[model samples]
Target: MGFMDRLFAREERASVEDPRVPISSPNIIAFLGLDALSASGETVTIDSALGVPAIWAAVNFLPGTLAGLPLHLYKRTSAGRERVTGGLATILHDAVNPGMSSFDWRMYMFGQVFTEGRGVSFIERNAGGKPLNIWPLDPCGVTVKRFEGRKLYEYKDGSSRKVTYEASEVIDIPFMLKRDMLGHRSPILTNKDVIGLAQAVTKYGSKFFQNGGVPPFAIEGPFQSAGALQRSAEDLAAAVQKAAKENRLALSLPAGHTIKQLGADPEKSQLVELQRFIIEQIARIYSLPPTFLQDLTHGTFSNTEQQDLHFVKHTMRRWIQQFEQEVNLKLFGRVNNRQYVEMNVDGLLRGDFKARMEGYAKGIQNAILKPNEARRRENLPDDPEGDKLLIQGATAPLGSQPARGIGDNGGPPLNDNEGNDDAA
Candidate 1:
């Protein structure tokens, strides 16, 4: 007999009235998604929420308490049970299974056993006319089968059938309640502890360095790249000095103060000096050679002074373009053919400057050797033959020995003045 029947039997033995007798379990209660197949080959689906309150009422109350209870009492008292069953049905509906109808039997039986005090021992019976007793004596020991597929339910009388449940459905009815449900609480780390953890990470990272090298900032200036030291005051001064020498700017005075003192007058006394300083600064900053600057602005200036000023302005454009183009190449990683053409133009100007300088040096040599009015007018030198003779003497090869000294004489003395002179 089921637990409800046993309670009813006990109530009868006590001779008390049955309060729930007038109202059948089906009329006062309903089960969501509940289905059953009877021996008559008829299937019933219980769709109402209150259709099966008897299962819960029977479990929660004593037998005589509900035996004569009114239908209204079942309706009002069944709210909590209805809520739980509705939630269970919703879980079943969302579960991974063919349909809730397939698992309706298991859900219904489980809900009944859960609400009613009947354990799995009474629910699961073996074929040998004995109870399976799957429910443990200790509440914590009870095992729950998470129904994933069709599980077979068998009776002690050897009746068996396949019962399927939705795999996604979960019934979390605990056998017992306790203070610590699972285990002790875990400890949490504080902010100070986290900082210590970060420090540990940095310490370990330090050990991984194979060379045991000092930090980069600890190295001296000369050890670093030229680019790294470019912004230093010493480097800037050196660059200015080198640029001044290459451009032939007179460095007898400091270039910086000279440019500032010259102001804007192109015809002023110090203007030419200022222009030279500016030109040198431009060439150094842009890394362009000075010859390239001079040839681009020919000799259009009215005087040597104006020529220096003109050269500074003319060269500034070329140097700026070249420096800007190089910067662009680094920034964008490319330069077009047009930019190369511009650079070639500057290079041609530089070549022309070199040729002019060579011709000027030759003229100076001619003037030095023959300083006479008539030779200057003819662009000729008075001692041209002397110069030719000097060139010929420089190219001539020495004989094996020199003419002998006045008396002693083999073929010649090897130590004659012609060979022995230190200058020779």
Candidate 2:
């Protein structure tokens, strides 16, 4: 049987039971589309937040880059650490289960983390406690609570009944935990106002352009009634649209009415600048550089490279460490487990040929990495002579070599006293 089938195989086959009472209500606001109403009068949920291009770019970039990096499992040994193969390693590095590749699973999990604020997974193990497979769980369907000092995960598994998993059985990672530790704070909910403003600005720009670059205006004339005034306004709007469509430079209005702009135009209100500022704000939310979001207004070659370093060190490293620790704790015990999973963040440099080659050269020359190992990184076939550590011959210990004369076959010159005594 598959992991899920075996997990629920023991439950009764009768009618589905009622869901167990959780410690508190599940955090389903993101999925339910009820996060919060922003100051711009827009409802900010996961969907609305993502509708903003900057937010979408940030979310997609973070999760995509992170998931695409290499993930491997390694075992600690007497000589050193070596990568583990087969079994759990295969599940982690290659595929989580038969139905899911490791990259897709990680992308899904991190996507939820960025949008819904939490990502969860369940570990399926054989009889000997050796992990067999890993299965992802929807955060919206899972509720966490502490009972009798132990944390429990109650998941709604598509039945009327809720399946319970101990903390040890679940792998949980939250963007940021609430004070209760049971609930997580979503990025969408936390920064709804900023994202809402972005949406409002985008919508306003679209509407403004849709009206043929004509801002809303006030029609001034001596009208007999409100009906007359409304009709005049509509007529004026239609004339403006017709003129725009016809590529006419002049808009023909009624004899006595004049069009007076009601509000500031996009240029006057600095719409472009506002949109750029919004992108910067979203970047801050994700701890990303604006350059990564395709904002190059202020990007320079030097600073852009610095931003890349910042992303790896300040942003991506934190998530990588968090995921590593969570998987380590879940897959192995806290105590004496020698096996653990690691994400190779250095994989990001794969696209930079110069950087990759330089790093490999340094590693091989310093004997920090075997030549075969460096070649393996580039997917090159290993040579028999490349398996050993290599270093420069000039790097030998200072006192290890004897002093040599300039022209004595690398030995001290013949002693003059001995040669002269024999001659005397």
Candidate 3:
């Protein structure tokens, strides 16, 4: 083959045999001593697949948000926030050790659990038998006992030693698909082809940038000595390499050489559409609007706000509810008047300043929130009149009907207004 032909061949080979592809493929041989997820054999593992832009955006967004939001313990009525002194609240707010705060701990654990389909943690108790510390167990390390009921956890200790745990000994929060007690079923395992295709597209886009997003160019030359020709080729190659590295949009070539571009234009190949399609597929897995995954080709000012609301209501709600229920179940179990945890998702749904302030004003006008509370929320100094719940003039409180006289319709006295004439 000619020099140009060999060069193109090498490029094709490099793209096809990318190291990012999993080991189970015919293109790659697995390392003998390697330990990797079964999912990794098909596509990238969850760890590597997270590097996919859409996946990273969705995954990091959830954990970070949940960690940052104000999670309070409240009664079933939700009238007043309860002060949960010890037990899970302390551990949730501060975590077990200085190595990780509650935010870091929850984010890490929740991220693992949500992505992998389950998160197992050991709730260690103090001398008083209250939960002193909560430590996460690697999902990969724990195996569920199908037939054996009492001995549920067959956990692989760090050094390969087997340590068995009873059902009560560990907290198993699973994202169940069907009847499986163990949360073994995951998207990585079930939707291998879709995820693999996504990874391929992601890798292609990355390589597109890494390879400088430059279309292939060729040089056609006039006759010169073999030595001169070789020297010219080397110089051209070096110049191209430099251009690629620096991301220079313009290029200059040598004299007596005609330049011809190779490959279809990005639009012709539908590169954007392909990436967006993959991103939408990923969003489906997470129950998010494609906009939440940053695919906003069709986004508008009106639709963008709606999309943000949809994300909070549809996407964020699902994950938040899951965490709330799991925390309540694992922490308090079945108990009367159990204080449950709830994330303040109202802030997320509330719109911009004008919309939010108007909503708050309406709340104050309707006596739902005292003006002082609204002022406090807005960081404004409290006014004496703001302490009162001021209702709109046209509206009246429910059951605040005109009082009836004694023995009137066999009821109590309706003498609330003595001077005014009493009318039915």
Candidate 4:
């Protein structure tokens, strides 16, 4: 009956009607088409996420490095695996098709993988089932589904006609698969909050500098009326702008006023530290080390070297394996495939001449690699004599005794000198 009692009764009825907690959950927001916003009030999509330098660096570095590596197709043989040439090998190593180079095609595929979380390529084959060319497909326009106990790809090629591809016809690589295995999770979308925060910090820094390195502040003054206070504030703001434009360090204010900073400066707010932390977070998302992203704030000579090894071993190896397996399965076949593709990660050591030479020397000396093989790795023309495996001959069994000359081995003795002496 009373106003307060009526309000309380209505609230109880509303709560009972809508018992669901978190009225504005992320899923709900997404359903309502409003979930692109992050807690830092920034929009995080693939394009916006790439605007962050660290993210851009990561996306480019991964695909670029992978694309530049030596890719070869090998066939199983009686003695060992031998490099295959001419058909798919030439396509994979030299060019994906007559138009695009292998590096460009691979880079395009992996760029899609990094940004959209999936990469798809259609394998065009001749009548005899020999692959003629590999064509890159836009992951954004492709939809994947499990149909009739098999995976199928429905690609929209900017036309009303949707082309359907069998799982065997496409080389599909996903950053991470969902529960259904048909869907994938994007690194940017899954970790948008962290990227959003990075964007916010970057925007803040830009704005701070844009206003002539001035932080937000308030003026505390003795005022007689609201209008006077307003006028004084406007005049003070104009003066500040003018001083900034003239590159003047000192600011003049009225007698009764003092400027109070509204927020902590960048250093006090730990902006640099936050930025470094953000780089680490992004690195974790990509399984890359901060050093790979050129974050050398904490890098030392020894640790940087270790980071390089970590990148090749931990980060790059997994991606290489995934890509190799995918291409091999689609291009060759899943079962009893004699031919396969491989990326020679040894190219990463090309820059470190000493390390590379030492590794090659060890491989050659241990008979694991022929001298010509090592020379080939260095892109040098091979010599005919360097084709054989070479190893050091100094090593022997611990108990073995040295073999002396004929006098010690029960062979012919040097009897002339001793016999002549006895006769004399």
Pick the lDDT winner. Answer: 2
Could you tell me how far off, in angstroms, the CA of residue 377 lies in candidate 3 after the best superposition? 4.3
TM for every model, in the order presented, reads 0.13, 0.85, 0.68, 0.84
lDDT of each: 0.30, 0.82, 0.66, 0.81
* Top candidate (TM-score): 2
CA lDDT of 163 in candidate 3?
73
What digit string (tens of lDDT, one per residue) describes model 3 on residues 1-424? Answer: 8775653342211113443332222122222222232332434466666767887897887778777776766655466555666656666776655466778767877676557766677767777666777777777666665332333666665674777675665776565543434434555434556676767666666766665775566668884788877787677767767888887767676677876777766778898788888788888877777887777888888998888888887877887887777777766676736577777776676578998899998998888999888777667999877778788775568888666666668875545554356553
Between candidates 3 and 4, the one scoring higher on lDDT is 4
Model 1 lDDT at residue 289: 40
Worst 10 residues of 2 by lDDT: 11-20
lDDT of 3: 0.66
Q: Which consecutive 10 residues in model 3 have the weakest lDDT in total?
A: 22-31
lDDT of 1 by residue, 200-289 (tens): 333433542221211112113343566654455354345445655466443343232221221223343354454454344434422334
TM-score for candidate 3, residues paired by index:
0.68
Q: Is candidate 3 or candidate 4 better by TM-score?
A: 4
Residue pairs with backbone overlap in model 2: none
Q: lDDT per residue, candidate 2, 142-174, as tens digits?
A: 877666556788788666877889898998989
Compared with the true structure, the alpha-carbon lDDT of candidate 1 equals 0.30
